[model samples]
Structures are given as C-alpha cells and as structure tokens.
Target chain A: MIEIQNLTKKYGQIVAVDNLNFTVERGEILGFLGPNGAGKSTTMNMITGYLPSTEGTVKVSGYDIAQEPNEVKKRIGYLPENPPLYTDLTVDEYLSFVSELKKVERSKREQQISDIMELLKITDVRKRLIRNLSKGYKQRVGFAQALIGNPEVLILDEPTVGLDPNQILEVRNVIKDLRKEHTIVFSTHIMQEVSAVCERIVIINKGKIVAVDTPENLSKAITKNSRFTIKIAGVKASVIGALKAIDGVKNVEVSDKVEEDVYEYIVDSDKQVDVRKPIFFAMAKLGFPILETKEEELGLEEIFRELTTKNIVVSTESDNSKQDASGEAPEEDDQAEEKEVE
Target chain B: MLSVYKKELRTYFYSPLAYVLSGIFVLVFGIYFLTQTMSKAGQGIAQIVFGGQLFFASFWLVMLIPILTMRVFAEERKNGTEVLLMTSPISVPQIVIGKFLAAFTVFLTMTALTAIFPIIISISGDLVISNTLSSYLGFVLLGASFVAFGLFTSSITESQIIAAVLGTVTLFFILLIDQLKTLVSGIFLKIINQLSLYEHYKQFVQSVISLKDIVFFVSLTGMFLVLVMIVIEKRRWSQG
Candidate 1:
C-alpha cells in the first residue's frame, strides 16, 4: 500500500534520511526500529507529505506524494512525535476539527468520530479539555485523531513513547487489532514493541537500513554461535577443563562463582553442535553434579544492539582504540550501546 | 478552507484573547467618539464625525491587530499542529485564506460594535450617510491589509511575541511612511509619501471613493497573503 524509493532528506551538509527504500503491504504492520537521531521521524514526515524529500519519491496507494500530495495524504493518517494537539480544545472539538480537515463526509463525521473514540477508549473524556487530561489520555486522543478519516495507511511516530507500561500494552494491542484493516508503519526504539506487533522489523541506524526481516529471522540470522551457561558443583578449574575437552566446545569461561565449589561457566560451541547433552554426560562422568543448565539464545535486545552498534564501532574504531588504551574496547562498546538505547 | 476557517473562528471564541481585544477596541473607540462629540458640541454640529474617530482607531490596529494575528500560525508551529495541517488534504493557499478570513471576521465584528455611535448621532441630528459608509469601507480595507501583514509575520516565526513585535513595528512604519518623507527629498520623498498607508486612507475619510485607493488596499492585502502562503510552502521544504 506504500512504497518509498531512495527517499533522502538533507539538511545542508547533513543527510537525515539517506536513500531509504522500503515498502508496506496492505494490512501489514511494519516496525521501524531505530535509536535516537536515527532519522525515523524524518522518514515518517516525508511519507505523510509534511516534508518534501530533497531527492526521491514516496507513493501511497500508487499516487506519487510529490505529484499528487492531496490524493496521497487522503489515504494516510499521521501521528507525529508530539501528537500535534491543541490543548485548549476539548477532545470532541479536536477530533471534529480533524475530521473536517480531513474532509470526511458531513453525514458520517459524528459516527466515525464516536467509533474512533470508543476504539481508543477515550469516550469518557470526550467532553473534557485535552490540557486537563493525563499524558496517556492525550496520546490516546492523538491516536483517535489519526483514526478519524478511516485512512488506509497509518504512520505513527512512537505512539507509545510517553505512556505508562499498561498504556503501551494497550496501544500495542490496538496496533495489532488495526492490522486487520489498516496498514501500519510505526517507529520506536523499544525492541519488545516491534516483536509483539510488527510482522516485519526494519532496523535503521545513522540514516541507513541495517537489517530488514521478520523478528525470528533477524534473530536467527545474526546468532551463528551456540552458547550455553552451566552451573556445576565442582572445582572451577576442573569444570572449565572438562567443558573445554568436549569435541565441539570452542571456549569455556568461568563467568561467576554461585556458591562454594559451584561455578557458572559460559560454554561456547560450533553452531551445528548440540553440546548440552554432552556437557551433562561429561559433568556426570567427572562426579560433578550439574546444578543448573540454560541454553543462552540471543534475545531481540542483543540482536538490536549487535546490529546497530556494529556500524558505530566500525566507523569510530580508531577513535575508540585511542580513547581506551587498556584494550577494554568491548566494555566501552557496551557503555556506548547503553547510551544509545537510553 | 471552510473547515479551517470554522476551526479558527471557534478557537478565537474559545480563547479569552479575542474577547479582551475586542473589548479594548470598543472601549477605545467609544472614548474617542465621546471626546469628539463633546468637543464639537459648541459648533451646533451634532453630526457623527467618524472620520477623525477612525483615524484614531487605525492606531489601535497597530496594537490590536498584532495581538489578534500573532497566534494564527505561530501557535500552530509552536504546538506542532502545523504538521497536522500540512499533512491534511487541504492546500497551503486554502489554509492561508481560511485563517485570513477568520481574523478579518473578528476585526469586522469589533468594528461593527462601534456603529452605535452613529446611531446615537443620527437620533439627534442629520446623519451623513455617504461619509459614514465610505469611512467604514476604508477602515475595513485598511484593517484587512493589516491582518494580512500580521498573518505574514506570524507565518515567519514560531514565537508569538516575536510575531507580534515584528507585525507592530513593520505596520507602524508602513502607516507612518509620510513622516519619513522629511528625511529624504526628490524621488525618495515622493516614494515615501506614495507608500504611506495613511495617505491612501485619508481619501476615504474625505469621502473620495477613488478606485486608485481601493485598488491599493486590495492589492496590498493580496500581496501580503500571497507572501504568507509562500512562506508556509517554503518551510515544508526548508524545515529540518
């Protein structure tokens, strides 16, 4: 339902969105995953006809945004990062104004607004001033505004950013339900938000597309090494030696000491190896009881960090190496990752 | 365009700024009316002299029109609501025209309330119908031009205060261009005198309904409104 081709936005010397190419099928929820300053909002603005791309095109329902903006805008409903609300207007008044601005039919305006208000669960606060409402309510009202014209495509820029956890869950559920009828392109820095609702995730960083695939495929493609964490009641040296002696074990590092004679070891092995059963038998043969065992599969959070941080590390490797003389580049990388995630 | 016009009008009524500004406009006009009448009472002239009253009221436009128009586009940009308007199906010209008309409506309403002075004068003495009507026509045209200028200033900035100040200062200069005639001579002095808004407005006050003055106000208003539309359209491409 939507196609973006080489969509680039430049602010003088800085390129905010660079040759971004993507598509959204009808009734599909495409997740836009990126950290701060990742040009997600810039991309969304171009798609909604609010901003003109310096060089490229965005088409909605086969109409070019630059050539026929009104036709494209007619099919897309956008909720910007700030929600674009008039605080002095009541909920009903704001929605009514949006409906009119969208050129909804006069006869169906009231019913459509009520239905949207009901879907967003903002019916009770319909008469109250939007300024007096809570943040969550304001967000829902913003969402309700996007649903007013029943547009085919909805471009929401961080719909759940300022909401509470429950409100976030509620919004996710709403997005999930919206997939039955509307094609959704939502941007967020939250990993779980995309994993929970989007059919395909597009991870972008520094104005470029890093990875695009389903959540499962993205995780599976990046994690090529099988890792296991095991806790055994034996001397730490013996536990490490026995684990390394296994046929497919690549490396064994004692990560922590859980208790006396009980050490946790992180076991790395070849991707094709099933080392869990072998490690169990090896520990049993050594008279070392296995206290606990866990197969450490990479979660979406790690995959996101790995995808987004790899580029940063490559671009600034020289600067990073000079900054950290102790060869703790990995630790510094982790700190940089944390800052980006926050 | 109609939708935006209605929404803007509704917003004006909802906010207290419109009420306060309109109240001040009426109060000031009433005071001027009473003073003009009291001072001319000894000449047996019970005629409602609105030409002088409107000339004074034009000064109030320097203050009140900016206050009325400062928030038209500046507030939208500040609140991030410009995104909503730009992304809608409406055209930039439509939004500009809609807002221009909404502000014009409020100015008309404020000026309409001053008609009571003429009604009171007509009850006691002869009413100069042509002069009163021409003066009002000139005032409306002049006010529309100021509204357009103020709207243009509002479109250029996100801060309402800056919009108001810019609108007030530029408009003050435009209205008082004749005063600057003293600083120049020859071609420059003629240019300054010709650019004076008060010069064009004085013809209407004297009941001279020349097409030249009418065209000047209409074209000036159109030019400013077009500038507002261009500024809004250009921002879409230039904004980061």
Candidate 2:
C-alpha cells in the first residue's frame, strides 16, 4: 500500500530524517518505534504529503507523493501529533468539514460520518464544541476526523498519546480492528503499544534506522545470554557458590538481600540451558530453601532502549534513570496527559 | 475550493472578530455619509455624493482588511491545522483562492450594509445612480486588492499580529505612493504613479469606469493571490 525509498528531510545544516527506506503491505499494521525526536513525526508527515521530502520518493497506492500528491493524499487519512483540530467547531461540524475537504461523496457523507463516529464512540458528543471536551474525547474526535473519508491508508502519529490506560487500550483495540481493512503506520515511543498492536516494528534513532523486525525477533536478537533471578534463604556466600556450581551457569552474584539469610542471586547461563530446574535441585541439595525464582526475559522496553541508546554511552545513564524514575508502564501516558492539561 | 470557502466563512462568523470589524466599518461609513451629506445641505440633494465617503472608506480598508485577513493563514499555521489542509487533496492554488473568496465575501457584505445610505438618498431626493454605483464598484475592487495583499501577508507568517502589521504597513505604503509621486520626476515619477493604488482609484471616484483602472485592481489582486500560493508551497519544503 505504501513504499518509501531513500527518504530524507533536512533543515539547512541539520538533517531531521535521513535516508529511510520501508514499505507497508496492504492490510499490514507497521509500527514506527522511536524515542522522542527520532524523526518519527517527520517521516510520517512526509508519507502523508504534509511535508515535502528533500530527497527520494514516497509512493502510496502506486502514486508518487511529489508527483501526484492529490492521488496519494486521496488514499491517506492522517492523524498528526497535535490532532489538527478547530476548537471553535462542534465535533459533527468538524467531521463534516473534513469529509468535504477529503471530497467524500455528498450522498454517502452523512452515513459514513455517523459510522465513523460510532466506531470511535464519539457519536454521543457529536454536537458538543470540540474546545469543551476533555483530552480523551478530543482525541476520539480527531480519530473520527481521520476516518471521515474512509481512506485505505491510516497514518497515525501517537494516536493514544494523551489517553488514560483504559482509553489507550480502547485505541489499541481500534487499531487492531482497523488492521483488517487498512494499512496502518503507527508511530510511538511506547514499547508496549507497538508490541500490542503492530505486526512488525521499525526502530529508529537519531534519524537513522537501527532495527526492523518483529517484536519477538527483536527481543531474541538482542538477548544472547539467558538470565534468572532467584531468592534463597541461606548464607549469601554458599548460595552464590551453589548457583555457580550448576553445570550451565556462567556467573552468579548476589543482586540484593531480601531479609536475614535471604539473598537474591542473579544467575547468568548459556542460551540453550534450562537452568531453572537445575538451580532448584542444587539449592534443595544444600538444604537452602528456595524462596522465589523468576526468569527475566528481556522485554520490548529493554530491546528499545538497547537499540536506541547504543553508541550514545554518555546519554544512556540519564535515559535509564529517566525510565526508572517513571516506573515503566504508565510514565509516557501520565507525562503526555500533564502536557495536554497545561 | 468550495469546501474551504464554506468553512472559512463559517469560521469568520463563529468568532467575534468579523462582527466587531463589520460594525466598525459600518460605523465609519455612516459617520462619513452623515457629515458629507449634512455639510452640503445648502446645495441640491443631487450634489450630496458618495465619492468623498468612498475615498475615506478606502483608507479605512488599509486598517480593517489586515485585521480581517490576518488569521486566514496565520491561525491555521498556529493551530497546526495547516497540516490538515496541506495533506488534503486540494491544491495550493485552490486553498489560496478559497480563502481569498471567503474574505472577499465578508468585505462585500460589509460594503453592502452601507448601501442603506444611498437607498435613503434615492427615496427622499434626487440621486445620480451611475455615480453612486461606480463609486461602489471602485470601493469593492479596492477592497478585493487589499484582501489579497492581506492574505499574502498572512501566508508568510504564523503570528496574526505580525501578519496584520505587515499588511497595514504595505497597504499604507501603497496608498501613500500617490502623495509621494508629486515629489519625484522623470522615470521614478512614472513608476510611482503607476504603482499608487489611489492614483488608479481617483478615476472611479469621478464616476468614470475606465477599463485600465479595473484591470490594475484585478491584476494587483491576482499578483497577491499568486504570491500567497507560492508562499504556501515554499513552506511545505522550507518549514521545519
């Protein structure tokens, strides 16, 4: 449905988006994953024909954007980062205006609009002014606006940015549902969002493509050593010795002390090893009761951080600290909501 | 183009700016009409003319038009709605022309309201219909040119106040060129005389419908509209 080749955008001496190449197959949900200012929005804007590329071509439905922008634009429904809303207009009024702007047929405009409003669950507030709505409702209206012409390609730039957890889930589900009919290119810094809804992920950093693969493959490719965290009630030195004595265990260290004589040991092993059962038996043989055990599978968050922050060692510590300060799951959501309110 | 025109027209009425500006325009027009007509009470009613009223009204446009068109493109850029328009299937020329027409419609409506002055004169006393109509035609043409200039200024900046200031300064300069023409001679005088908007406007005030003046206003309007489209297309490449 879409093909982008050698796409580049530069601002004087600064290159914003550098030599990107990707394609979205019909009905495929492709995730554009990157940290803040990773040229995600710039790439999306170029794809949607809102910004002209400094180099290369973006062809949507076989029409080159620079040469045939109207044809390319006709097949795309874009939700920009800011939602492109007119606060003075009502939801219905805004959607109707978008329908007209998109050149939806006069006969089908009303029915199509109502159906889209129903899909986004914004029908109830259709008559209300957009300025008076909360952030979540306003976002839904923006989504509804994008759906007005029923374009075959949907370019959503952080569609769930300011929504609460429930709203985010709802938007994720909407994207999941939309995958059946439209080719979607969704961009976000949130790791979980891409893993939840996108079939394939494109990870970019500092205006360059770092990794492009399935989420599962990306995690597997980055994690070469299997790691385990286990808590045992025994003398710390002996616990570490037993864990290290295991056949496949490469290294063992006391990660933390949970309580008196109870220490958490981080065990590293070969990739092919199933060291959990062996560690359990080894601890039992030493009469050191196993308090708890967990295999720490590297998640998309780690993969994202590893891929994005590589070679930028000076900034890695601060990025990790920032991620740690926000407790992982709802950090981006909370920060974005705070910004919306302000 | 029609879609943009409709939406822009609706936006003008949705805010209080249009109403306030139109009210001021009418108030200014009425004051001019009353003073011009009352001062010539000793003469016949046929001598009570709209020529002076329209000439003064043209100056008011140098102030009012910038305020009217300041938000046409600047607000869209500020609110991030330019993305919506630029990404749509509409061409840059279509968007510029649609916005120009919408602003022109509002100017026409404001000009139409002042027709009440002429209507009263026609009913109570003798009135020269051709003179009154020609003055109106000239005023509308001048306004169209001012609106196009204002729209071009708006397209170049994201700040509405800055757009307004740029528009007012340029329009004031265009109007003032007529006075400056007398101070120069030779080729410079010829160029200034041709560039002066009021110099072309003077013939219409005398109830003359010269095609040259009509063509001048129209070409000026077209030049500004084209400049607006160029600015928009250039920004698509140059804006960050």
Candidate 3:
C-alpha cells in the first residue's frame, strides 16, 4: 500500500534519512526495527505525509504523497511517537473533532467512536478531559483519532511506548485485530513487538535500510555461529585445558567466573556441530563435573545488534551506513520521544 | 472548518483565555460606547457604532491576535498534534483555514459581546440600522484579516512566544505605516497607506461600503491565509 523511493531527509548537514527505498505491501504488518536515531520515525513521517522528504517520493495506495497528500492522508491513521492530543478537550470531544476532521459521515461518527473506544478499552475515560487521562488512555485516544475515518492504511510510530506490560499486550492485541482490514506499519525499538505483530521486518540503521526480510530469517541469518555457555565446578586452568581438547569446539573463551568453585565459559562450534553433547562427555571424563550447560541460542536482540552496529553486511553495495557519522547519534536520539513534540 | 471552529471556541472557555480576553474587550468596547453615547452632545448612535469599529473595536483583535495565534501551529509543534492533522486527509490549506476560522470564531465572540454597546447606545440616540450593520461587517472582515496574520506567524515557529512577538510586530507595522509611507512618495505612499489595516478601517466610520474596501479586506484575509499554508508546507518539508 506504500512505496518509498530514494527517500532522504536532511537537516542541513545532518541527514536523518538517506537514499532509503522500501515498499510495504497491502495487508502486511511491517515492523520497522532500528536502534535509536535509525531514521525509523523519519521514514514513517515521510510515509504518512506528516513530514516531507528532502528527496524521494512516497506513494500511498498508489497516490504520490507530494502530488496527492489529502488522498494519501485519507488512507492513513498515524500515531506519532507521542500521541498528538488536545489535553483540554474531553476524550469524547477530542475524538468527535477528529471524526469530523477526518470527514467521517455525520451519522456514523458517534457509532465509530464508540466502537473504537470499546476496542481500545477506553470506554470508561471517554467523558474525562484528555489532560486528566493517564498516558495509556491518551495513547488509545490518539489511536481513536487515527481510526476516526477508518483509513485503509495505519502508520503508527512507536505505538506501544510508555505503557505497562498489560497495556502493551492490550495495544498489541488491538493492532493484531486491526490487521484483518488495514495495511499496518509500526516503528518501534521493542524486539518482541516486531516478532509478535509483524509479518515482515525492515531493519534500518543510520538513515538507511540495512536488511528487509521475515523476522525469523533475520534472526536465523545473523546467528550462524552457535556458542554454548558452560559452567563447570573445577579449577579454571584444568577446565580451560579440557575444553581445548574437544573436537567440535573451534575456540573457547572464559566469559565470567561466577563463583569460586564454578568457571563460566563460552565455547564456539563450527557449523551445525552438536558441541553440547561433547562438552558434557568431555567434562565427565575429567574429575570436574558439568554444573550447568546450555546451548545459548541468540535472541532477536543479538541479530538486531549485529545488523545495526555498523558494517555487518559485506556482500551488498547498497549505500547505507557509509555516509552516516555512526554511533554519535544515539545520545541525541535518546530524546526521540521528546523530539516528536518539537 | 466546523470542527476547528468548535474546538477553538471551546479552547477560549476551557483555557479561560477567552473569558479574560472578552473581559478586556468589554471593558474597552463598553468604555468607548459610553463616552460616545452618554456625551449626548447628540453624537448619532450610528456614529458611535461606526466610530467604535473604526478605532477601539480592532484593539480587541490586536491583543487577541497574540494569544489566539500563539498556539496555532506553534503549540501543535509543541504538543505534537501537528502530525495528527498533517497526516490526516486534511490539506495544508484546510489546516490553515480551519485554524484561522477557529481563531476568528473566538474573535467573533469577543466582538459579539460588544454588540451590547450599540444596543445601549440606541437607548440614547437615533440608530441608523444600515450604518450600524455596515460597521459590524467591517469589523468582522478586519478581525478576520488579523486572525489570518496571527495564524501565519504561528506556523513559522514552534515557540509560542516567538509566534506572539512576530504577530505583534507584523500587525504593529501594518497599523503604523502612514508616517513611513511618506518616505516613498505618491503611488507608493498611497498603496502603503491603503495596505494599512487601520486605513481601510476608517471607511466603516462614514457608512461607506465601497467594493474597493471589501476587496482590500478579502484580499488581505486570503493573502495571509495563503501565506500560512505556504509556511506549514515549508516547515514539514524542512523537518518531516
């Protein structure tokens, strides 16, 4: 439903988004995963017609963003990192105003609002002023505003930020329910959110698209080297010597010495080798016993770090992190939440 | 536009900024009306209404322009609601127009309170109905133009104080250009004088509703509203 090409947003010397190209298919929930200052929100802003790209074209539902912003706007419900809300207006009044602004049919505006308030579990706070409502409720109200016209595409920027665990799950489930009808793209730093709601994942770093694939594939691709963490009750010197003798083990490094009797080590295995079994067998042969051993399967987080930490992908010549200043942006970007209001 | 109008009207009451502003307006509008009507040196009721719109009524717009305009795009940028509207199906023009009308509605309420001035005046002297109506119409158009200017200033900055200051400066210059206009003679001075808001405001005092004056007010409103639209467009491009 959305196609962004050569999209670059520059603030004078600093480029926020650089020569980015990606397409989000209709009915797919695309998770935009990036570290802080990865241009995820900038890309989202350009896509939703909130901010204009310095260069590049964004087409929403086949309409060019620059040429037909209103039509594109009609199709999108955008919740920025901070929910744009009028604190003074009651939740009912705020949603009603949004409904009218979105040009929802006069007769159905109330019904649509009621349904959304119910779906987002905000029925109780409907009558209260938005200022008095809690952050989560304000977010839901922001979501209600986005849903006012029932747009075909929903572009949410950090939708689940600042919520309690329960509220996060509630918001996630609501988004899952929304996927049946609308094309959804949400940007977030949360790893579980991407795995939970998105069918496709786009990992961005330094204002560029680093990799785009299914979450499973991205996780699997970055974790080819299997490392096992084994804690053995023995002298560190003997355990190190015994570990070096194992055939499947390519290299072993002492990760930490957890206790006086226990030595914690990370053992690397070359290509699909079942080194855990060998390590247990080897430790058994020696007087030292295997206290605890587990194959440390890397989570999505490691995969994300591998992709965003700089210069991980070697084969492709897509101009991504080359132009960026690298790592200097994270501190400034910690205020991503605050910058939304600026 | 209706949504904007309603929200803006509610903002005045909710923030009590409107009540405070209306209180100021009534004080000035009432004092002026009383001095003219109670003079009974036999100043016409039409004269008071006409004269009130000419000089004093617009002061309400002047002071109000800052408060009403301060929060337009600037506060949205502050609170982050500009994204909500910009990302919606609303066009730049619509955003500008909606906000302008909303502030204008607040201005309208302030002016409406001053309606009591004319009513109180009619109790003392002859009230020519057509002239009183023309004066009110002139006030509406002029108030609208100032609101448009205020909206334009708001769109240029995220700081409300900056927006308010820019609005005051822009309005003050427009109101006081007659002396400055003389530096550049003849046609230039005439054009500059005509461009002055207070200059056009004088036409309402004599009961003249010339098409030229109407065109000037309408063009002023349109031009400022268009400028606001352009400012918002450029801002999004720069920051989005």
The ten-residue window of minimal lDDT in model 1 chain B covers B43-52
lDDT of each: 0.86, 0.85, 0.79
lDDT of 2 by residue, B37-126 (tens): 877775645556667678888899999999999999999988889999989999989999999999999999999888898888878776
> Residue A98 CA error for candidate 3 (Å)?
1.6
Better of 1 and 2 by TM-score: 1
DockQ (CA atoms), all models: 0.64, 0.56, 0.64
- lDDT for B89 (candidate 3): 68
Q: Rank the candidates by TM-score, best first.
A: 1, 2, 3
Model 3 DockQ (Cα-based):
0.64
* Candidate number of the best lDDT: 1
- Real contacts recovered, all predictions: 0.87, 0.79, 0.81
Stretch of 10 with least lDDT, candidate 2 chain B: B41-50
TM-score (chain B) for candidate 3 is 0.88
What is the fnat value (0 to 1) for candidate 1? 0.87
